[model samples]
Target: MTAKRRRFVRDNGLTLAFGMAFLLALTGQAFAGHAEFNNELAADGLAPIGLAAYLASSEFAVDVTENWQSEYLQFFLFILGTVWLLQRGSPESKEIDEAGPESDKEQRVGQYARADSPHWARTRDWRQTVYSRSLGLLMGGLFLLSWFAQAVAGSAAYNEQRLRQLQRPMGWGEYVLGADFWSRSLQNWQSELLAVASMAIFSVYLRQRGSPESKPVGTPHGATGVES
Candidate 1:
Protein backbone atom coordinates (compact mmCIF):
# COMPACT_ATOMS: atom_id res chain seq x y z
CA MET A 1 0.00 0.00 0.00
CA THR A 2 1.06 3.60 -0.54
CA ALA A 3 2.38 5.36 2.59
CA LYS A 4 -0.51 7.80 2.54
CA ARG A 5 -3.05 4.98 2.17
CA ARG A 6 -1.49 3.09 5.09
CA ARG A 7 -1.61 6.22 7.26
CA PHE A 8 -5.27 6.76 6.36
CA VAL A 9 -6.12 3.17 7.27
CA ARG A 10 -4.21 3.43 10.53
CA ASP A 11 -6.02 6.64 11.42
CA ASN A 12 -9.45 5.05 10.85
CA GLY A 13 -8.85 1.37 11.41
CA LEU A 14 -11.61 0.91 13.98
CA THR A 15 -14.36 2.49 11.90
CA LEU A 16 -13.15 0.86 8.68
CA ALA A 17 -12.97 -2.57 10.28
CA PHE A 18 -16.43 -2.38 11.82
CA GLY A 19 -17.92 -0.92 8.62
CA MET A 20 -16.61 -3.83 6.57
CA ALA A 21 -17.84 -6.31 9.14
CA PHE A 22 -21.30 -4.71 9.08
CA LEU A 23 -21.56 -5.12 5.31
CA LEU A 24 -20.41 -8.72 5.50
CA ALA A 25 -22.88 -9.52 8.27
CA LEU A 26 -25.71 -7.82 6.42
CA THR A 27 -24.89 -9.80 3.28
CA GLY A 28 -24.90 -13.01 5.29
CA GLN A 29 -28.25 -12.12 6.84
CA ALA A 30 -29.70 -11.42 3.39
CA PHE A 31 -28.66 -14.85 2.09
CA ALA A 32 -29.83 -16.66 5.20
CA GLY A 33 -33.12 -14.75 5.44
CA HIS A 34 -33.80 -15.34 1.76
CA ALA A 35 -33.44 -19.08 2.20
CA GLU A 36 -35.63 -19.13 5.29
CA PHE A 37 -38.27 -17.03 3.57
CA ASN A 38 -38.30 -19.32 0.60
CA ASN A 39 -38.89 -22.28 2.87
CA GLU A 40 -41.92 -20.51 4.33
CA LEU A 41 -43.23 -19.83 0.83
CA ALA A 42 -42.77 -23.48 -0.13
CA ALA A 43 -44.74 -24.57 2.93
CA ASP A 44 -47.55 -22.19 2.02
CA GLY A 45 -47.70 -23.55 -1.53
CA LEU A 46 -46.53 -20.12 -2.84
CA ALA A 47 -43.74 -19.69 -5.38
CA PRO A 48 -40.33 -19.13 -3.84
CA ILE A 49 -38.92 -15.64 -4.30
CA GLY A 50 -35.65 -14.70 -5.95
CA LEU A 51 -32.87 -13.25 -3.82
CA ALA A 52 -33.44 -9.77 -5.24
CA ALA A 53 -37.18 -10.09 -4.68
CA TYR A 54 -36.64 -11.22 -1.12
CA LEU A 55 -34.23 -8.35 -0.48
CA ALA A 56 -36.82 -5.85 -1.72
CA SER A 57 -39.71 -7.41 0.21
CA SER A 58 -41.34 -6.14 3.39
CA GLU A 59 -40.01 -9.15 5.27
CA PHE A 60 -36.40 -8.08 4.74
CA ALA A 61 -37.10 -4.44 5.42
CA VAL A 62 -38.93 -5.10 8.69
CA ASP A 63 -36.22 -7.45 9.90
CA VAL A 64 -33.51 -4.91 9.14
CA THR A 65 -35.34 -1.89 10.59
CA GLU A 66 -36.46 -3.59 13.78
CA ASN A 67 -32.84 -4.34 14.63
CA TRP A 68 -31.63 -0.93 13.52
CA GLN A 69 -34.19 0.89 15.68
CA SER A 70 -33.19 -1.02 18.78
CA GLU A 71 -29.46 -0.51 18.20
CA TYR A 72 -29.93 3.23 17.69
CA LEU A 73 -32.21 3.44 20.72
CA GLN A 74 -29.44 1.88 22.79
CA PHE A 75 -26.92 4.54 21.79
CA PHE A 76 -29.47 7.33 22.15
CA LEU A 77 -30.34 6.38 25.69
CA PHE A 78 -26.72 5.79 26.66
CA ILE A 79 -25.63 9.18 25.36
CA LEU A 80 -28.40 11.08 27.12
CA GLY A 81 -28.23 9.06 30.31
CA THR A 82 -24.49 9.49 30.65
CA VAL A 83 -24.96 13.24 30.68
CA TRP A 84 -26.87 13.27 33.98
CA LEU A 85 -26.65 9.78 35.46
CA LEU A 86 -23.45 8.13 36.53
CA GLN A 87 -22.13 4.86 37.80
CA ARG A 88 -19.57 4.90 40.63
CA GLY A 89 -16.94 2.60 39.18
CA SER A 90 -17.59 1.74 35.57
CA PRO A 91 -15.30 3.18 32.93
CA GLU A 92 -18.47 3.46 30.83
CA SER A 93 -19.60 6.27 33.16
CA LYS A 94 -18.20 9.63 34.20
CA GLU A 95 -16.53 10.27 37.58
CA ILE A 96 -19.25 9.98 40.22
CA ASP A 97 -18.78 13.59 41.32
CA GLU A 98 -19.45 14.83 37.81
CA ALA A 99 -23.13 14.59 36.94
CA GLY A 100 -25.25 16.70 34.66
CA PRO A 101 -23.69 18.95 32.02
CA GLU A 102 -20.52 20.57 33.35
CA SER A 103 -19.47 24.21 32.98
CA ASP A 104 -18.75 25.78 29.59
CA LYS A 105 -15.05 25.80 30.52
CA GLU A 106 -15.06 22.06 31.16
CA GLN A 107 -16.73 21.48 27.81
CA ARG A 108 -14.59 24.17 26.06
CA VAL A 109 -17.68 25.88 24.71
CA GLY A 110 -18.47 29.59 24.32
CA GLN A 111 -15.49 31.72 25.47
CA TYR A 112 -13.59 28.67 26.65
CA ALA A 113 -13.51 27.13 23.17
CA ARG A 114 -10.04 26.94 21.62
CA ALA A 115 -9.28 28.34 18.21
CA ASP A 116 -9.31 24.83 16.72
CA SER A 117 -12.66 23.99 18.35
CA PRO A 118 -15.72 23.47 16.18
CA HIS A 119 -17.47 26.66 14.98
CA TRP A 120 -20.65 25.73 16.77
CA ALA A 121 -18.79 25.22 20.05
CA ARG A 122 -17.43 28.75 19.90
CA THR A 123 -20.93 30.21 19.58
CA ARG A 124 -23.46 31.06 22.29
CA ASP A 125 -26.40 30.78 19.90
CA TRP A 126 -28.94 28.10 19.17
CA ARG A 127 -26.39 26.39 16.99
CA GLN A 128 -24.18 25.79 20.00
CA THR A 129 -27.11 24.40 21.95
CA VAL A 130 -27.99 22.13 19.05
CA TYR A 131 -24.43 20.97 18.50
CA SER A 132 -23.93 20.22 22.19
CA ARG A 133 -26.62 17.53 22.08
CA SER A 134 -26.18 16.59 18.44
CA LEU A 135 -24.91 13.04 18.96
CA GLY A 136 -27.80 11.97 21.15
CA LEU A 137 -30.23 13.91 18.99
CA LEU A 138 -29.12 12.17 15.81
CA MET A 139 -29.26 8.74 17.46
CA GLY A 140 -32.74 9.41 18.84
CA GLY A 141 -33.91 10.68 15.46
CA LEU A 142 -32.55 7.61 13.68
CA PHE A 143 -34.20 5.36 16.25
CA LEU A 144 -37.59 6.98 15.76
CA LEU A 145 -37.30 6.84 11.97
CA SER A 146 -36.19 3.22 11.94
CA TRP A 147 -38.89 2.24 14.40
CA PHE A 148 -41.49 3.95 12.21
CA ALA A 149 -40.14 2.14 9.16
CA GLN A 150 -40.26 -1.13 11.08
CA ALA A 151 -43.88 -0.55 11.96
CA VAL A 152 -44.89 0.16 8.38
CA ALA A 153 -42.89 -2.70 6.87
CA GLY A 154 -43.88 -5.04 9.66
CA SER A 155 -47.54 -4.35 9.05
CA ALA A 156 -47.14 -5.30 5.41
CA ALA A 157 -45.16 -8.45 6.18
CA TYR A 158 -47.57 -9.54 8.92
CA ASN A 159 -50.65 -8.99 6.77
CA GLU A 160 -49.06 -10.90 3.90
CA GLN A 161 -48.68 -13.91 6.20
CA ARG A 162 -52.23 -13.48 7.46
CA LEU A 163 -53.48 -13.54 3.91
CA ARG A 164 -51.49 -16.73 3.28
CA GLN A 165 -53.31 -18.27 6.28
CA LEU A 166 -56.72 -16.99 5.03
CA GLN A 167 -56.92 -14.42 7.82
CA ARG A 168 -57.93 -10.79 7.59
CA PRO A 169 -55.39 -8.02 7.11
CA MET A 170 -54.78 -5.55 9.93
CA GLY A 171 -54.57 -1.78 9.74
CA TRP A 172 -51.28 0.02 10.33
CA GLY A 173 -52.47 1.32 13.69
CA GLU A 174 -53.66 -2.12 14.73
CA TYR A 175 -50.43 -3.83 13.72
CA VAL A 176 -48.24 -1.28 15.51
CA LEU A 177 -50.22 -1.92 18.69
CA GLY A 178 -50.37 -5.69 18.14
CA ALA A 179 -48.34 -8.51 19.69
CA ASP A 180 -46.12 -9.35 16.70
CA PHE A 181 -44.71 -5.86 16.38
CA TRP A 182 -44.11 -5.54 20.11
CA SER A 183 -42.53 -8.97 20.23
CA ARG A 184 -40.07 -8.16 17.43
CA SER A 185 -39.19 -4.76 18.92
CA LEU A 186 -38.99 -5.90 22.52
CA GLN A 187 -36.77 -8.88 21.73
CA ASN A 188 -34.11 -6.70 20.14
CA TRP A 189 -34.49 -3.95 22.75
CA GLN A 190 -33.96 -6.32 25.66
CA SER A 191 -30.75 -7.70 24.16
CA GLU A 192 -29.28 -4.29 23.43
CA LEU A 193 -30.21 -2.96 26.85
CA LEU A 194 -28.66 -5.98 28.47
CA ALA A 195 -25.44 -5.42 26.55
CA VAL A 196 -25.24 -1.81 27.72
CA ALA A 197 -25.96 -2.78 31.29
CA SER A 198 -23.35 -5.51 31.21
CA MET A 199 -20.72 -3.22 29.80
CA ALA A 200 -21.34 -0.59 32.45
CA ILE A 201 -21.30 -3.05 35.33
CA PHE A 202 -18.57 -5.38 34.15
CA SER A 203 -16.09 -2.64 33.30
CA VAL A 204 -15.97 -1.74 36.96
CA TYR A 205 -13.90 -4.85 37.67
CA LEU A 206 -12.75 -6.15 34.32
CA ARG A 207 -9.56 -5.16 32.53
CA GLN A 208 -9.02 -5.02 28.79
CA ARG A 209 -5.39 -3.92 28.65
CA GLY A 210 -5.28 -1.16 26.04
CA SER A 211 -8.98 -0.80 25.13
CA PRO A 212 -10.55 2.57 25.83
CA GLU A 213 -13.77 0.80 26.83
CA SER A 214 -11.99 -0.65 29.87
CA LYS A 215 -10.03 0.85 32.73
CA PRO A 216 -6.27 0.34 32.94
CA VAL A 217 -5.25 -3.06 34.25
CA GLY A 218 -3.86 -1.60 37.48
CA THR A 219 -6.62 0.92 38.05
CA PRO A 220 -8.62 0.53 41.22
CA HIS A 221 -12.14 -0.79 40.90
CA GLY A 222 -13.40 2.34 42.71
CA ALA A 223 -12.08 4.61 39.99
CA THR A 224 -14.65 5.67 37.43
CA GLY A 225 -14.12 6.64 33.81
CA VAL A 226 -10.37 6.05 33.83
CA GLU A 227 -9.94 4.66 30.36
CA SER A 228 -6.74 2.91 29.26
Candidate 2:
Protein backbone atom coordinates (compact mmCIF):
# COMPACT_ATOMS: atom_id res chain seq x y z
CA MET A 1 0.00 0.00 0.00
CA THR A 2 1.04 3.59 -0.62
CA ALA A 3 2.21 5.75 2.34
CA LYS A 4 -0.95 7.87 1.97
CA ARG A 5 -3.18 4.80 2.11
CA ARG A 6 -1.31 3.48 5.15
CA ARG A 7 -1.62 6.80 6.94
CA PHE A 8 -5.31 6.99 6.14
CA VAL A 9 -5.89 3.49 7.44
CA ARG A 10 -3.96 4.20 10.64
CA ASP A 11 -5.83 7.43 11.39
CA ASN A 12 -9.25 6.01 10.49
CA GLY A 13 -8.58 2.84 12.44
CA LEU A 14 -7.68 4.79 15.58
CA THR A 15 -10.84 6.91 15.20
CA LEU A 16 -13.01 3.85 14.71
CA ALA A 17 -11.39 2.13 17.67
CA PHE A 18 -12.14 5.09 19.92
CA GLY A 19 -15.69 5.33 18.54
CA MET A 20 -16.27 1.68 19.30
CA ALA A 21 -14.92 2.11 22.82
CA PHE A 22 -17.25 5.06 23.37
CA LEU A 23 -20.28 3.08 22.18
CA LEU A 24 -19.27 0.13 24.30
CA ALA A 25 -18.99 2.30 27.41
CA LEU A 26 -22.31 3.98 26.63
CA THR A 27 -24.00 0.61 26.12
CA GLY A 28 -22.57 -0.61 29.41
CA GLN A 29 -23.89 2.50 31.15
CA ALA A 30 -27.32 1.92 29.56
CA PHE A 31 -27.51 -1.66 30.77
CA ALA A 32 -26.34 -0.75 34.27
CA GLY A 33 -28.77 2.18 34.27
CA HIS A 34 -31.64 -0.04 33.19
CA ALA A 35 -30.89 -2.49 36.00
CA GLU A 36 -30.61 0.22 38.62
CA PHE A 37 -33.75 1.93 37.31
CA ASN A 38 -35.70 -1.30 37.52
CA ASN A 39 -34.40 -1.85 41.05
CA GLU A 40 -35.75 1.56 42.04
CA LEU A 41 -39.06 0.79 40.31
CA ALA A 42 -39.35 -2.48 42.20
CA ALA A 43 -38.63 -0.73 45.49
CA ASP A 44 -41.44 1.71 44.72
CA GLY A 45 -43.87 -1.03 43.52
CA LEU A 46 -43.78 0.37 39.95
CA ALA A 47 -43.43 -1.66 36.77
CA PRO A 48 -39.91 -2.10 35.46
CA ILE A 49 -39.04 -0.93 31.98
CA GLY A 50 -37.34 -3.13 29.44
CA LEU A 51 -33.87 -2.26 28.16
CA ALA A 52 -35.24 -0.58 25.03
CA ALA A 53 -37.80 1.37 27.04
CA TYR A 54 -35.21 2.38 29.61
CA LEU A 55 -32.85 3.52 26.84
CA ALA A 56 -35.61 5.76 25.50
CA SER A 57 -36.48 7.06 28.97
CA SER A 58 -35.69 10.54 30.24
CA GLU A 59 -33.72 9.02 33.11
CA PHE A 60 -31.08 7.68 30.76
CA ALA A 61 -31.07 10.81 28.63
CA VAL A 62 -30.71 13.11 31.63
CA ASP A 63 -27.93 11.10 33.23
CA VAL A 64 -25.95 10.95 29.96
CA THR A 65 -26.57 14.58 29.09
CA GLU A 66 -25.67 15.85 32.55
CA ASN A 67 -22.22 14.31 32.32
CA TRP A 68 -21.82 15.40 28.70
CA GLN A 69 -22.73 18.97 29.55
CA SER A 70 -20.24 19.08 32.42
CA GLU A 71 -17.41 17.77 30.24
CA TYR A 72 -18.12 20.23 27.46
CA LEU A 73 -18.49 23.00 29.97
CA GLN A 74 -15.13 22.10 31.52
CA PHE A 75 -13.42 22.25 28.13
CA PHE A 76 -15.26 25.41 27.13
CA LEU A 77 -14.40 27.20 30.34
CA PHE A 78 -10.84 25.90 30.42
CA ILE A 79 -10.16 26.82 26.79
CA LEU A 80 -11.51 30.32 27.23
CA GLY A 81 -10.34 30.84 30.81
CA THR A 82 -6.76 29.72 30.23
CA VAL A 83 -6.41 32.75 27.97
CA TRP A 84 -6.57 35.07 30.95
CA LEU A 85 -5.70 32.69 33.79
CA LEU A 86 -2.10 31.72 34.26
CA GLN A 87 -0.95 28.43 35.78
CA ARG A 88 2.74 28.39 36.49
CA GLY A 89 4.57 25.33 35.02
CA SER A 90 1.49 23.47 33.85
CA PRO A 91 1.33 21.99 30.34
CA GLU A 92 -2.43 22.62 30.15
CA SER A 93 -1.84 26.42 30.24
CA LYS A 94 -0.32 29.09 28.11
CA GLU A 95 3.00 30.62 29.15
CA ILE A 96 2.99 33.91 31.14
CA ASP A 97 3.83 36.08 28.12
CA GLU A 98 1.12 34.46 25.94
CA ALA A 99 -1.96 35.85 27.65
CA GLY A 100 -5.10 36.80 25.68
CA PRO A 101 -5.78 35.99 22.02
CA GLU A 102 -2.59 36.13 19.96
CA SER A 103 -2.22 38.19 16.78
CA ASP A 104 -3.72 36.91 13.49
CA LYS A 105 -0.17 36.32 12.21
CA GLU A 106 0.53 33.95 15.10
CA GLN A 107 -2.79 32.20 14.40
CA ARG A 108 -1.94 31.92 10.67
CA VAL A 109 -4.97 33.89 9.48
CA GLY A 110 -5.32 36.05 6.35
CA GLN A 111 -1.91 36.64 4.70
CA TYR A 112 -0.10 34.39 7.20
CA ALA A 113 -2.35 31.46 6.24
CA ARG A 114 -0.87 28.49 4.40
CA ALA A 115 -1.88 27.67 0.81
CA ASP A 116 -4.02 24.76 2.00
CA SER A 117 -5.57 26.81 4.83
CA PRO A 118 -9.35 26.78 5.28
CA HIS A 119 -11.23 29.17 3.01
CA TRP A 120 -12.61 31.07 5.99
CA ALA A 121 -9.06 31.63 7.26
CA ARG A 122 -8.27 33.45 4.01
CA THR A 123 -11.65 35.13 3.48
CA ARG A 124 -12.38 38.79 4.38
CA ASP A 125 -15.87 38.04 5.73
CA TRP A 126 -17.90 37.17 8.76
CA ARG A 127 -17.17 33.49 8.19
CA GLN A 128 -13.47 34.21 8.56
CA THR A 129 -14.15 36.31 11.63
CA VAL A 130 -16.15 33.53 13.25
CA TYR A 131 -13.71 30.87 12.12
CA SER A 132 -10.89 32.75 13.83
CA ARG A 133 -12.49 32.18 17.23
CA SER A 134 -14.27 29.00 16.12
CA LEU A 135 -12.59 26.59 18.55
CA GLY A 136 -13.76 28.38 21.68
CA LEU A 137 -17.07 29.25 19.99
CA LEU A 138 -17.74 25.64 19.04
CA MET A 139 -16.79 24.48 22.53
CA GLY A 140 -19.15 27.05 24.04
CA GLY A 141 -21.92 26.04 21.63
CA LEU A 142 -21.54 22.36 22.50
CA PHE A 143 -21.58 23.26 26.20
CA LEU A 144 -24.86 25.14 25.72
CA LEU A 145 -26.40 22.38 23.60
CA SER A 146 -25.46 19.71 26.09
CA TRP A 147 -26.71 21.82 29.01
CA PHE A 148 -30.01 22.38 27.21
CA ALA A 149 -30.28 18.67 26.50
CA GLN A 150 -29.73 18.02 30.21
CA ALA A 151 -32.47 20.47 31.15
CA VAL A 152 -35.02 18.98 28.75
CA ALA A 153 -34.18 15.42 29.73
CA GLY A 154 -34.01 16.27 33.42
CA SER A 155 -37.49 17.78 33.25
CA ALA A 156 -38.89 14.59 31.80
CA ALA A 157 -37.09 12.50 34.40
CA TYR A 158 -38.28 14.79 37.19
CA ASN A 159 -41.84 14.61 35.96
CA GLU A 160 -41.63 10.83 35.84
CA GLN A 161 -40.53 10.80 39.47
CA ARG A 162 -43.28 13.21 40.38
CA LEU A 163 -45.92 11.08 38.67
CA ARG A 164 -44.54 7.97 40.37
CA GLN A 165 -45.00 9.70 43.70
CA LEU A 166 -48.57 10.83 42.75
CA GLN A 167 -47.35 14.47 42.68
CA ARG A 168 -48.05 16.99 39.93
CA PRO A 169 -45.86 16.90 36.84
CA MET A 170 -44.08 20.22 36.25
CA GLY A 171 -44.01 22.24 33.06
CA TRP A 172 -40.67 22.90 31.30
CA GLY A 173 -40.44 26.43 32.65
CA GLU A 174 -41.31 25.34 36.14
CA TYR A 175 -38.85 22.48 35.97
CA VAL A 176 -36.09 24.86 34.84
CA LEU A 177 -36.74 26.99 37.91
CA GLY A 178 -36.87 23.94 40.21
CA ALA A 179 -34.12 22.81 42.55
CA ASP A 180 -33.77 19.44 40.78
CA PHE A 181 -32.40 21.08 37.64
CA TRP A 182 -29.88 23.22 39.48
CA SER A 183 -28.86 20.38 41.75
CA ARG A 184 -28.10 18.11 38.82
CA SER A 185 -26.28 20.91 36.94
CA LEU A 186 -24.33 22.19 39.92
CA GLN A 187 -23.21 18.75 41.14
CA ASN A 188 -21.60 17.85 37.84
CA TRP A 189 -20.25 21.35 37.30
CA GLN A 190 -18.59 21.46 40.72
CA SER A 191 -16.87 18.15 40.13
CA GLU A 192 -15.59 19.26 36.71
CA LEU A 193 -14.28 22.54 38.12
CA LEU A 194 -12.56 20.71 40.94
CA ALA A 195 -10.94 18.26 38.54
CA VAL A 196 -9.73 21.01 36.21
CA ALA A 197 -8.40 23.03 39.12
CA SER A 198 -6.67 20.01 40.63
CA MET A 199 -5.02 19.12 37.34
CA ALA A 200 -3.70 22.63 36.88
CA ILE A 201 -2.30 22.88 40.38
CA PHE A 202 -1.16 19.28 40.77
CA SER A 203 0.82 19.27 37.52
CA VAL A 204 2.91 22.05 38.96
CA TYR A 205 4.42 19.74 41.58
CA LEU A 206 3.90 16.30 40.07
CA ARG A 207 5.52 14.26 37.32
CA GLN A 208 4.30 11.20 35.45
CA ARG A 209 7.08 9.47 33.55
CA GLY A 210 5.36 8.87 30.24
CA SER A 211 2.12 10.84 30.48
CA PRO A 212 1.63 13.95 28.39
CA GLU A 213 -0.29 15.40 31.32
CA SER A 214 2.92 15.62 33.33
CA LYS A 215 6.35 17.10 32.98
CA PRO A 216 9.42 14.80 32.72
CA VAL A 217 10.40 13.00 35.91
CA GLY A 218 13.81 14.66 36.08
CA THR A 219 12.58 18.03 34.86
CA PRO A 220 12.23 20.80 37.41
CA HIS A 221 8.75 21.59 38.72
CA GLY A 222 9.12 24.96 37.00
CA ALA A 223 9.48 23.30 33.59
CA THR A 224 6.35 23.11 31.43
CA GLY A 225 6.12 20.39 28.78
CA VAL A 226 9.38 18.49 29.16
CA GLU A 227 7.85 15.05 28.70
CA SER A 228 10.07 12.01 29.16
Global lDDT of each model? 0.96, 0.89
Candidate 2 per-residue lDDT over residues 1-228, each given as its tens digit:
999998887889968888899899999999999999999999999888899999999999999999999999999999889888888788777777888888888888887888999989998679889998888898899989999999999999999999989999999999999899999999999999999999998988887878877887777778653445
True-vs-predicted CA distance for residue 207, candidate 1, Å: 0.7
Candidate 1 Cα deviation (angstroms), residue 169: 0.5
Report how far off residue 135 is in candidate 2 (Å): 1.6
Poorly placed runs, candidate 1 (over 4 Å)? none
TM-score of each: 0.99, 0.89
Highest TM-score scorer: 1
* lDDT of predicted model 1: 0.96
Tens-digit lDDT string for candidate 1 (14-115) = 999999999999999999999999999999899999999999999999999999999999999999999888888899899988898999999999999999
Positional deviation of 204 in candidate 2, in angstroms? 1.7
RMSD to native for every prediction? 0.7, 2.4
Error of 2 at 222 (Å): 1.8
